[model samples]
Target: MERRPRARLELSDRAWQVLAQAGGNVAVLHRHLTAAGGQVPSLASLYRVVHRDLEAGRTLPDRAVVRRDREERHTRQAMADLALASPRQGDVAEAVLRLPRSSSTAASAVPVGESGAVAGVGLPAGAQLVRTPSVRAVAEPVGQAMAAEGAVCVFGDPGRGKTVAVRMALSVVPAVWKVTWVPVPVRPSVAGMRRAVFDALALPGRFPHTSALADAAVAGALGEARVLVIDEAQRLPVPCLEYLQSLCDHPGTRITLVLCGAGTERALARLPQLASRIAAWQEVPRLAAAQVAPVVTGFHPLWRTVPAEDLAWIDQSCAHGTFRTWAALTTHLQNALLTTADTSLDRALLARLCQRVAPPL
Candidate 1:
């Protein structure tokens, strides 16, 4: 008999599980296999195994790099807790957090009970929800534009959660749409602003000048994205804002253009043509006491560790109508919790935390 080919090896279910868990790290696989009473295969053999599994559709070739901002991290945990607590209707937004980005680049699904780091107790709910009448009034029209191809403008008070809402929308929208979120830096020079848009769109950096760059970037995004959300759009000088108006000139391209910023209404007023093109517009306002419960719920568990009464006071003081201040207070509270592990937050501790606030941005 022709020398029997060395018996071909077939990985057991246990081996496949180990490989999948390692996400194709060959070194890890080898170690696991050797420890499991199997000989460590040569690199070439390992490669074949992976290749074969991929060809057979047994494994995904690439793993995802998942990162979540603070509010989102909390929303994810809450949704998970909600899911286990009551399995009926899940929080649609939280489901998106858990989904793979490639599957839903803008939307993701968050796992419950992963950790308290992201969804701690102290996060404010108003930052996460669009509770303002102005925001609620415009959300549908904005959602329609997002569903089609175009953009909407969200202008509001500083720290009123303009950025937060835009992010939350991305967390809820369908995956087929591409959501490109760019926050316009404060007082950015015309040139720098254009560069930021280009980077967000992953376009080439070189540009003739600021004006040309703005014209090109908006047009480029309109050509590709389902929706382009520009946060802090109020900072864009008149010239750039006017150029942005041109992006929606053609109704056929199907692009949603969202312009968001503090006091954006004044900026939009200057661009008559762009303002005219705006099918919908609104000014998001600061959070109210009714909304404090949601904000408190969203705060990471670390925030919850602080006594409720102390948090109530901080909320009342920061409720002076600024999201930035609210954020600072939360950070201060987080630091206090980390260093002291003192769950019993009081008015005195609040005073110490308040000291950390930068003279009201």
Candidate 2:
């Protein structure tokens, strides 16, 4: 005898209502249905039913669509509330909302050879951003951390371009994810760190007085998916790190924490609890010897005019493959070219400028 094909599972009106109330979260809907104690399908089967309904033009929205709509609504409401609370802050909020939401938009936002700088390091107006291997190395782990909603630690020696590279990678993140860059204050306390997070998020109204109330506010705001970048994280004390861990550990919050600094690895090592949760540890090393000529030449037109051998000599003598040093050298070269028509870029002139910028070597 031929067996009958199993019937397709269907969602009831009540189930649909639960799904809607859950903001299209299928897992939540499944749990609700299971708790109601009826003939409930497996999670996988429920997902198939939902997918079928979606393709059939059902009114229920997909989880992601629903989430985006809700976030947009919340952002608008927050702006209005902030405007009423403080006009200056409201203006700031408006400016933040205008930030580029997609990778293409972000790339266009910062044009090459413009006055814009990365991570507060001054770049020469004639300098161009080159996508080096170090940048690609950073982008991979940063992207992974964002996708997994986990933690990542980006560490390197000073001037190795860790912050700049991380910023570059984050600039390309999809528009759906909210990215918050928290500037770690010098010698920060937990309270100070909490306030920094609150300010970074641009949460409306004044910060709360009590720690409990402040954390509640922060946790509530973090209910939506967000990537929190704590730059110069090495400055954070154990208490502050624990505080951040608490925020990430909140059951309702979906947070991807990125700790970036020169000694971030060592800092995280001090806190095994937080370190254990890191999904990736990316280190930005100095530019390789082979990359010196190409990277610096692409970085500025002045370098392009310099011979390959001279560029290598300069790297070996002073720049030592550091991006910050290259930026400084480029600025000096650009100035020398513009200010003095007679001045030519030679090893002698390069040596003088290198002495001004590079550490003793």
Candidate 3:
């Protein structure tokens, strides 16, 4: 059996900050280490260390600066202390119930990457829940399933705000609805895919075979009204998608399945049966150039730090369009934000950040 890595390093002050900002990417951790005048670890080794920390439920060490006010400091302490204490949908539901109240002025807002979800998000005016045709239709069915049972999937492009929209919708749900969010794994194989979903749901059983396990899992899920929202649904193989389709079969299941992805209409062509069974389908289009400004204006403050020209480029590129590309560009701008002093992005800065985060197109 392969042994898990055991090497550990005492993180520096800057390392903690970088880890907090990077979320969980080991590549970013290595970059921050090198930038902070430390020897860099190999990619594999760094990943092992980061994964170990995550598994052990460790968070950034307490800082000595003590810069925050009493409330903010208390919130940070609580967050750190409760790092690994939150339960899943069918579990105790502590984290969802005890979420920190939104500050009148947020201390910092993090950007959502193509693969990650953004918190404290807002929808653009025309994209509002009441006005947007696509979003409005999708929201009702989703809200119904959520009220009946917590948890559901809102599959879509990486930065198309699938997660954001779900978060918004859940906010309207009653407190009795226990909401827990996790990113859907985008693995390729059937077995690997099953493990991903099982691990995500934190289900109790395991299977030696992927097919058998998937059927059993879906059967069990269909008995309850719990919504399992699978984002990036296009990436799942045919077998995996079929299992989701099976959930629609049970009437009492009330399991609402929302699948969002780039070119979803085209992607669904590959699964005609599953596609036809979908009760509601919503197309989330990229914001047009004219629509980008208002959207950006309504974005979280940290996002505002991105230069206007960069936002314009993002809007244009996304309009062309691809969620994968938009997500990559957003990560670049976020890294730039950490170093910028005047605290806003510039065209040159945006260009440089883009180049560094993504390859030449």
Candidate 4:
């Protein structure tokens, strides 16, 4: 792709005067433009002019800041060249992301990679399963609880792989079961959760006005063997939690509720009636420092050739033992590789990779 220079905005002389009065501050200029009764364009338009002026040395004080910002913007996009995708679409959001129940998955017995080879994620690309300790810990128990007609709660810090762990559990579910995933709304309500379940199950007609009628309808839809997977349960309101509890405890309803979220225990504690019904509670922990290299090596091709010491430094500097942090690091690293075509991963390169996100890496 050929690079194109941004079209500069020709602001009025009065606008430039206001900008100068504001000391090259775009926000202040925008405010002044609004206050002076001029038909001001959007803030973004003002930023473009300021940025354009700074780039050509029209504003020296703001130049250093704008240049650093521009450098980071480019750095963030650094890895677009290497992204490979195997796209397939299914549920918009499954309560827990799972391999379709029809797909057969061989349990990955491959221990975390110890070999320093520069190949890829070792596993076949189309393999249905992505096994890890956290996934196993979550999958096995949730499966057991659902089988026994019990409720389970999985909680942990944000981005600790709670959702992935649940997906791993869902892979082995027999085809006979109907699993419903109800995502909690931003501001949870009893009515919202009921509607979400009703929508997932494709129940007949709109949600009933009465809670009892809605509960009965949902229970009927979820026959003898069913699982309700609730992601982001921490955001669910007390009434919403109680509503799920009603379904879980109903003798006629053979529904097993698996709730995954961060701070779910604390949230559920406020709803003691709902909390008491939970048969199992597990916390998904972040990856340890020692396990970073093998995990990264198995996750993608980009990190396979990264040296062991550099990998550990990456784990410390940005990964910070969290799955999401590792993901962030990998994204930046991929862009870095694409940008510079670096032959080998080095400390300086690693620091540069995370400069946009962390403090001086």
Candidate 5:
């Protein structure tokens, strides 16, 4: 007996456009297509089509290429602005430091924690919040943005405490302001985003079925003085970002939007309309060398006992001034201390723990 012909998978023009808009992100494209209400192929099938039909044949640009182009454009714009404002002395050094560093290089040089928990990573029991320079630097802008009902974008490499800084800043806002932290859904879409906002605001009614009704409900709730903090905002696709812009632009809504994420600046770059309206863009850098000892010691009691030289070695060897790494290292050190009767914190012990957390060199 003859077997039936295997079905073919093809992406329509609209789907292709969605793929392009998604910057060749197969997962996001698949989500958008599925959400748009159609019989979309399985993710694996879509990946096969994207790689074999689109990428290999050059019908679509590679994601890396798209990312590089965006980065170059941003770098040029930054350089121009820096040139205009920068003083003559130390201009080269300042420019080098200010330019966006690639994640790989930053990771090689430096280092998910829960959103807004503590120090971007969840605070271990008995851990104290240390006001590092990055945290202090973010607080003012965050406060100003909340007070003015403006937008602020807090972005940096992951695990550097960007989320915690924003949370700390929001903590001080006067009791009158209703602060809502909207958790960004994985592979988010406009609809998912709307639901997140509705749930986050604790609106009285169920989420509306249609876009118009949902927007109406969201805008009505946002009419109150509210600070909407969206953490992990870098996960937002273009459509979702546009949806946020719509809420912020709504006349009835009195909302201060704070977007926090790793690579959030690059995400915002995809939508200049939203980026242009932001009042402040705060970047949380890694803990500086000088701050490592003081900040890490303050972050946990365990670190207080570690000698300064050893702490410095830990930073250089693994932690690289990254709070998340430090948090992980601290946990490991704590476990070692508790489990082993004669455990000592030293370079040899740190090397073994660092191996667990640090990526292979």
Candidate 6:
């Protein structure tokens, strides 16, 4: 048997800086540090640091050790504008103190339930109507983006409810708003995306079929109430994403942009111009172990018939408590109950379904 190499307990400042420069790529940093001297940490230690940061709050896999100066200047402009909104700080301070603080701290913040409880409120919902703290988390930024008519990106794993959360958030927008939702095309390309935009906003045929004119037409159609939501935005061509960024900068017709998909951060990174201008970057989280009962029961009437223990099993074993997973499993079970005479969601039924959805070793 071979022994695994252990990670160093402490790393030198030079090693840490190298790791940061490498964008938290431990292997690269390790090679560099080892070539320089023996001060570098092993991959295990790197994983430890990454996992700890992830558990704490940071969602990105490789978060470069960032400093304030690295932040884009325009991103802070919004904060300044918000601060300038208050003519008198004294009045705003007094009012802000009276408003809720404990809950609105961060998107990941959850309410404290009784001792040993999940520390969050449960909104009994069903199907597309499923409501929870996670939805509220995604909604806040969307609402702010709507107000600022800026840009936002919502990203998460598959079936994590990114689409549903965006829909629910947009539902609260005023009726006067002109919204266009364009789904990603099968074979993504800049030209295809331009066509999609033109069709969605109903741009006139007389307009020249050039990217510049398309941007002009889209911008002209935009107002404070106009918003374009691109779903599965990760599949978008890099050029198109950057082109949309140009649209964001169009003189007076700044429209709100909501880009929702998995791996959205990576896609945005490819277009630094667009990524820097993003007003909000929200990640929709999956359901937790404790939320199995509340979310499932409220999600659909079928869940009411399922046993609580079975619900927990499905959450942990099958669906993993994600919004789409739960909804899909529910559908399969509902179909089983109706078409077949199963009529029951026993552990055996759930196990079989789990195997169908996600095979276990």
lDDT of 6 by residue, 1-361 (tens): 8999985365557656566656767788768866887455677776787567657775432343253223323434433343222312432233222112223221221222322122122322233254467776787787678666678899999888787667655644444456688767887787778777778887667646677877667677774357799998888778888768766777767578999999988999988888998998999877887766766665566676777888887777677767766666777776787798645667888788777777557
Better candidate by lDDT, 2 or 3 = 2
lDDT winner? 2
Candidate 1's TM-score reads 0.56
Query: Which run of 10 residues does model 3 get worst, by summed lDDT?
Result: 124-133
lDDT of each: 0.56, 0.75, 0.50, 0.66, 0.74, 0.65
lDDT of 1 by residue, 78-133 (tens): 43343222212355433323221123222122333333212322344222322233
Q: Give the per-residue lDDT digits (tens) of candidate 2, residues 1-361.
A: 9999987687889888678768777999889878889777889988888999989999875667666666656644543343222212432222122112222211122344222225454567855565567876787777666656789899998988888777666655545568888988889998899999999999999989898989999999998778899999999889999998998889989888999999989998889999999998988888888777666665665676788888998889887878888888888787887898899788889888888886665
Error of 1 at 92 (Å): 2.0
TM-score versus the correct structure, for each prediction: 0.56, 0.71, 0.47, 0.62, 0.67, 0.62
Per-residue alpha-carbon lDDT of model 3 for 225-286, expressed as tens digits? 34456656667767766655655665545454556555555656687887776654555555
lDDT of 4: 0.66
Query: Model 2 compared with the native: what TM-score?
Result: 0.71
Comparing 3 with 6 on TM-score, the higher-scoring candidate is: 6
Deviation (Å) of 240 in candidate 1: 1.0
Candidate 4 residue 214 Cα shift, in angstroms, is 2.2
Model 5 pairs whose backbones collide: none
Cα displacement (angstroms), candidate 5, residue 277, comes to: 0.3
Better of 4 and 5 by lDDT: 5
List candidate 6 stretches off by more than 4 Å: 1-128, 204-207, 359-361
Report the Cα lDDT for residue 77, model 3.
46
